[model samples]
Target: MSDVFSGVYEINSPDVVSEYFEDQAVILNLATGHYYSLGGIAGSLWGLLIGGHATDAILENLAAQQPQLVEGASAFVAELISFGLIRQARAGAPGMSIDVAWTSEAPKLEVFEDLAELIAADPVHDVDLEAGWPVLRPQS
Candidate 1:
């Protein structure tokens, strides 16, 4: 509970995206191009975590629903942190918000390492460099 994120955790931006199907989920880290799949009660916890629940509350709620998950949930959360999917929320910085259909089975967060290169690029960038916008005049 003393982890840096105990205060708050937000999804790493410009780097991650998540989609859920019922209680299952697919998460993509655009920067690394690595996508993750989560399901069971773990996916449900993800929804709460991203929805702005502090770590303690999420763990408490989920652990109450599925006592066996008390051990794995922490590990899974650590994985999320290591994968750069979630991090300490900065003051007033909004965390991820998603529509999650809750489930109460078990907890698990899976990573697919081979698909990074295949996932199409998400180019997040600055419009202006050192000075002004580069002219995009059409050929004429």
Candidate 2:
């Protein structure tokens, strides 16, 4: 992986909610009770983030997995930050990257709701969304 492709992030889904499918780029934030979903190119970038990949590494990986989205990775990442889906680690760490973790608490709801809406409205009804939706998956 390149400088842009090193780090890891995890996507979390709600344990109580049950309205969406798996494979959707939906995440919930227990701290803020917010929901977020990354569809299309944004979805890919979100995946990279959850994988614990650094921002740069995310861009590089996305460039390869989704060439058409390479150009938009930077902006998309910025948007994700603005949306509070991700955050930087330390203030001055080299290769400092954002980390995404999954939560099942009530307070955290940033990514879950957004992802649910996306899954319900997916025009293509992509199977990937089915795999990502935590609600649709069998309980462990």
Candidate 3:
């Protein structure tokens, strides 16, 4: 781990919102309207990231639980950064490390663009006055 990624991270707020359900995490980037699904190990990793744990601490914790996952941790966090869902926090917060049980599953970030246009549309301002609040303008 030469390039030991340091610092904690925070979700891109005011534009991104995420919720974890069961073993999956649903993250929506309102500005882009591209939602992502992260399940299993990826979902658990996300929880840890948002928990404000330092990257090095997170990797160390995950590696302790599942040595194999450390190899993918950097890429997983990179993917999250590329998607504009999270960014390195200016001031790191003190937090706990990963707590999920070890697993061999490879972390993944599943992206969906099916409802991008609709999701990005402003329901309160982009709706047709005659058609009502729920009726949004057709995809352009």
Candidate 4:
């Protein structure tokens, strides 16, 4: 739990892709076919965590920059954990750059977990030859 913040975490899957917006981000898990949208301060935290900053260090930086975040950072990171967006590493990861860019805003972790069912079926393999693409029958 707290280990997600006390130690080091990294994106363990090569299939994961992230796209950032102004203060939000969308992460896609190609393998699981699940997409996630991270908004508010959760976006900033995602960049730092993936950049290899240790848990405590990121918390320190977040606390220093946005004291308001200190209260809920743990729960947010836990959410990231449950979503499988981040994983603990055997050793502390390097590349600790805490100078994350962005204006301070209220911190909240909003995870959109409704994409799995939409993407779990393989279009290329599961679609009917007559129906073509965009015609997958949802996997059960």
TM-score of each: 0.69, 0.43, 0.87, 0.79
Q: Candidate 3's residue-wise lDDT over 33-114, tens digit each?
A: 8999986588877887887878888887778777877878778888898888988888877665356686778888899998
Model 3: residues with Cα > 4 Å off, grouped in runs? 2-4, 95-97, 138-140
Compared with the true structure, all predictions reach lDDT values of: 0.66, 0.47, 0.82, 0.72
Which pairs clash inside model 3?
A: none
For this target, which candidate reaches the highest lDDT against the unseen true structure? 3
Q: What would the per-residue lDDT of candidate 4 be over residues 20-127, giving only the tens digit for each residue?
A: 876578888776877877767777778877777787888877777777766577777787788787888777666656786445765566545566755766777887
* Residue-level lDDT tens digits of model 2 in 50-128: 5455566655545554555554556566555565556554322346453423222111123445445444433444335
Worst 10 residues of 3 by lDDT: 93-102
What does the lDDT come to for candidate 2?
0.47
lDDT of 3 at 20: 77
Q: How many backbone clashes does candidate 1 have?
A: 1
Specify the poorest-scoring 10-residue window by lDDT in model 1: 120-129
Candidate topping TM-score = 3
